[model samples]
Target: MDLLDDDELERSAVVANCRMNRERGLLGSNGYDRELGFNPLDVLRKPSGESRPAGWLDLCCGSGKALIEAARIVHDEGMDVEIVGVDLAGLFRRVDPDQDRLRLVEASLGDWRPDRGFDLISCVHGLHYVGDKLALIARAASWLTEDGLFVASLDLHNLKIADASPLGRRIAAALRRAGLEYDRRRRLVSCRGRKAVDLPYRYLGADDRAGPNYTGQPAVDSYYADA
Candidate 1:
């Protein structure tokens, strides 16, 4: 089976048709707070005496509606926060002219890098279409602040090796060893604080025609080789 690289994966219809997280809001049953297991606003709020501005980076932020809403709350509460949302499709909703603290960017997670560490970083069902999910996860985890939180919806079955084995248990054990937690039931991966994780696998490519998994949506299958 021929697999697609990162750039090729981006152009595939399977990745383009991913809409599981496009309309997610900030504070509802189907919202970031519920998906991430914590309120990002609470993480961004300044502590009792600290003065540094809190930062949040949301990856694959479909329309950026959640980030925009968070920006409005930050402004209304007079909180020192910076919100940055990035999406590969670049189809974000327009924000108010005065929502200066919020920035929506169009970029690929494979190459995008933030200039500053964030107190909270989230990726909602974004890795389903990514070619190198582990690499991107490692990069995102490393972008966290000393006490930051990183969370994302990840389906372990989508990660596999050359023989088509999912390697789910092995991967989960490795992730836990690296200070990351994987909730098998929820299909959520989370990490506290910054970590430089080096999973012993080399990404080969991705199969965009893998069809649907647990999410009942078309998803990509990433293949890897032992490093």
Candidate 2:
């Protein structure tokens, strides 16, 4: 799929902007926070103090938060790595300047085609928005080099039969049609790993002891899916 097409890119931007606005309102804040969950860059750090990866791609990288983190890791570790962030909303454009090592492209995860494959690809909290989840996963897989890693997250809470939106229902239907087994009760899956991993769904401002009240909300279940 070619993501650079004008019409698709424009539509994708509109959806992304809407999502960003909704999330901003939910948080009641404009700044991005780091304590949300696991950091991919930190996970990629090596003990030898060497570079992380030759190149990094942040798919559906809204506001460039993850991309910024990756760039900081590269700079602090003195790694010669290139970082590219692709998002439909164009949020990265509004980020502060001095992101020299980072490049933001307006593209849809459902259709983007990078010039070169990446050594590490991250799709954080953005896969469910795509119209075709499996197609998007296939495309991302195609963009990974051998032994490359692909990190993706999906929100099972968003798929609740009671709270799910029409789009979410459609996504669930698609997954069913594709024969992908998903546990609606547990809100978790083991598509990539042998054991099911409990997805962390902590609110941006909520306390840890608050329990999983965030369930049935728009939370992401991250996975290190094979690339």
Candidate 3:
């Protein structure tokens, strides 16, 4: 079996055309609030007026609808918030020009770095297509503010190895030790504050033909060697 590197994985049909959460909103049955188990707006804090707007970074932000909706709400409420939505496809839905606080970016999360730390960072179902899931997670976590919140949906089964049954347990333990929490049943990983996570594994590559995960979507399986 052949494995694809990050660049190859990004160019693959399964990843380039992935439309996960394309139309998801900020709040609703199929929205960020429900998916994240809390209203993202509640976590957004504006300190001492507009001197420094609260930042929210949404990775793999397909279509950026949710962030756009949040931007509208912030505008209406006169809240100081800056929202950035990044997607590899870069095919974002049309938005109004009045949305000055919202920025839709097209780039690969594997190498893209934000200019500033975020108060809240989310990745929805985006990690399903990433080649180096753990490495990205570590990078995202490190990009958070001291009291920032980072949440993402992750399928542990996709973290592949030669013998992966015990890999899940080990991974969960390592994450916990690094101040990140993994919900086994919910397939979610979350953390409060910035964490410098150094997992003891090297990313070998990814298998894009691994098939469907719990999301009932075809996802990539990341392989790893030893550190």
Candidate 4:
């Protein structure tokens, strides 16, 4: 429907609405109500053997699910970790007020500047909505400490243009205008480095498992760069 044709502000609003609707549906349906389901704590725990008390940032942390998960990981590991959740929408209100461990900030990722770099920065299911993928990655890279981790998850389903669908072609053209490119075969791609990485995709819903409705092999790619 060329939601972004109006303006950047309108585009952000459209993306935000899509995210809110999908999140409400998913949570209401109990589609991910299991213990730590869809949370990154379980994923982060695997490689962080005995890593103590590190700072974590959850960029575009919608509804603060990942922020809560990061908080749990810090508490359980007894690590002196501080968790920060930032998003364009005020979705942080959905988080419990009693959880002092998590701090939520209402700001676009492009405008936010943290005082200190984090040990780990996560952009789960939020990278695709950004207007400038490379610039965002560079900004994210700037906010990382040495050897800090940056985890991003992008959906491939919305990155393609089908001849049969006018909407799809419009989306593809918009992405081209933005100078972004994506591969649809890989469902999810993760980039970690001190320098900016070029990763691309389309704006799906706020959840990793939502939108584009295409199923493919999930992939995670990691890289190390000096700060």
Candidate 5:
């Protein structure tokens, strides 16, 4: 089947209404904190009295509850930090309308780009919806500051070429060559520094027909144009 275009996917009401349904702490039941092996707040925390502002960017941020919660924590700690979140979803609630440090944007991650780099960038359970996971990873890496960290949840099997053929090892090789680390067991991709890298495939679009991922919930499949 031909993959759905990015614009079409973005306009889908079903796709745009998704939410993370954040809890008080674990964000969701995904064990994200455990997989990360560190508290996100630690990375976001600035010295209690420092004036230097730190920033974080979260892509495919869903309802941006995690960013909002983080913003509240940092604010209560009296640290200067800025948190920006972007998602394709149509409606996202502002955790704190009074907090200027937090900005939740509703837009497609496929085309949206941050104006500045961030100390940390993350996409939690977001890659599944992307049509070009590798391209987006490369783009996210570029959005990170020097020595900054970029992390996302990814399933290698969800990637395919124009013919629905999996790139398999080629994807890992490209990511490593570009300085990103893919943890197959964790189903996570991470990088600590930014580098320019290109893959051999062109993104055709996404497949929403595929249903129920490992989490027993529906997710999108990414299709690429293979050479």
Candidate 6:
């Protein structure tokens, strides 16, 4: 359901929930847990010929506390890594304006594109407010280096076409064909390799009047024209 415009967002609510999301144990890389099967250090271990520093990128990063904590841990352990967090929120907490490693950006994910590739990228529960989730996923996948991970939490039922027809099954099949894995139980979509993908539908804009989503939070609904 749509309760926010593309240019306007529920930043305060999202930032507030970010703390809850972390407490609920949804922030995968928090304080580095190997049991979670996610290790940001692994991104550094992977061989890379690129000149840019190996790093992590977070979409809708909110207060960016997770990344900040990660930087502190890496610093204490003497690891070299940078973090870039992008969110539409006007201001973020726990942000050191002068901090060099963890960079926080304020902008819509739809318009914010990084100039470099990343080894690990995540969007924890950020898709709930996106108008074109599929479009973002496709672009996000392209921003990863080979073996780089692109993980995003997505709700299948939250997506629909212009006519309000549920395309959950059809979209899941499309993701598989595109080399991405959709975990139905977790409501997550992830992939390791980057490949050009073409979906069977064309974006027909979005509806910001739909209402709240399964999480009881304001969300954007995308409408794609059937191919």
Model 3 TM: 0.95
Angstrom error of the Cα, residue 219, model 4: value is 20
lDDT at 219 for candidate 1? 93
**Clash number for candidate 4:** 1
lDDT tens digits by residue: candidate 6, 1-227: 34344454443344234432333232353433322246555556534565557778888776666667666656676566788888776356575544567788888787789988888888877787677788889999999877788888788877787678998899999999999999887677988866666778877656655566666765567777777
Check candidate 4 and list the clashing pairs: 53-80
Best candidate according to lDDT: 1
Per-residue error for 152 in candidate 6, Å, reads: 0.2
Per-residue alpha-carbon lDDT of candidate 1 for residues 21-88, written as tens digits (9 for 90 to 100): 67889998988888877788988877878878899999999999889989999998899999999999
Candidate 5 per-residue lDDT over residues 1-227, each given as its tens digit: 96688788766543653644333243444534664656676786765675557778878776666667777877787667888888775356657665778888877777788888788888877787676788889899888877778988888888876777776577888788777899888788999976676767777788887776764656778877654
For candidate 5, the TM-score is 0.88
Taking the tens digit of each residue's C-alpha lDDT, what string does model 3 give over 1-227?
A: 58899889988887975557788888999898888888899999665654778999999999988988988899899888999999999888887888899999999887799999999999999999999999999999999999999999998888877543335677788899888999887788998999899998888888889888888889988888768
Judge candidate 3 against the unseen true structure and give its global Cα lDDT, from 0 to 1.
0.87
| lDDT-superior candidate, 4 or 6 | 6
Give me the candidate number with maximum TM-score. Answer: 1
Return whichever of 1 and 3 wins on lDDT: 1
Weakest 10 consecutive residues of candidate 4 by summed lDDT: 218-227
Q: What's the lDDT of the predicted structure labeled candidate 5?
A: 0.74
**Where is model 5 more than 4 Å wrong at Cα?**
17-32, 46-51
The candidate, 4 or 5, that scores higher on lDDT is 5
In angstroms, how far off is 213's CA in candidate 4? 6.7
By the lDDT metric, which is better: model 1 or model 4?
A: 1
RMSD of each: 1.0, 11.0, 1.6, 9.3, 2.5, 3.9
lDDT of 1 at 83: 94
Candidate 4 on 1-227: residue-level lDDT in tens? 23232135423433565342124222324222231134444333424564554567777677765466556556667555677878777655455554566788878776679977777676655656654443565577667776666655554333332221223344334434443333334433333445544434333212222233332322211111112
Name the candidate, 5 or 6, with the larger lDDT value.
Answer: 5
Candidate 6 deviant stretches above 4 angstroms = 1-5, 8-52, 96-99
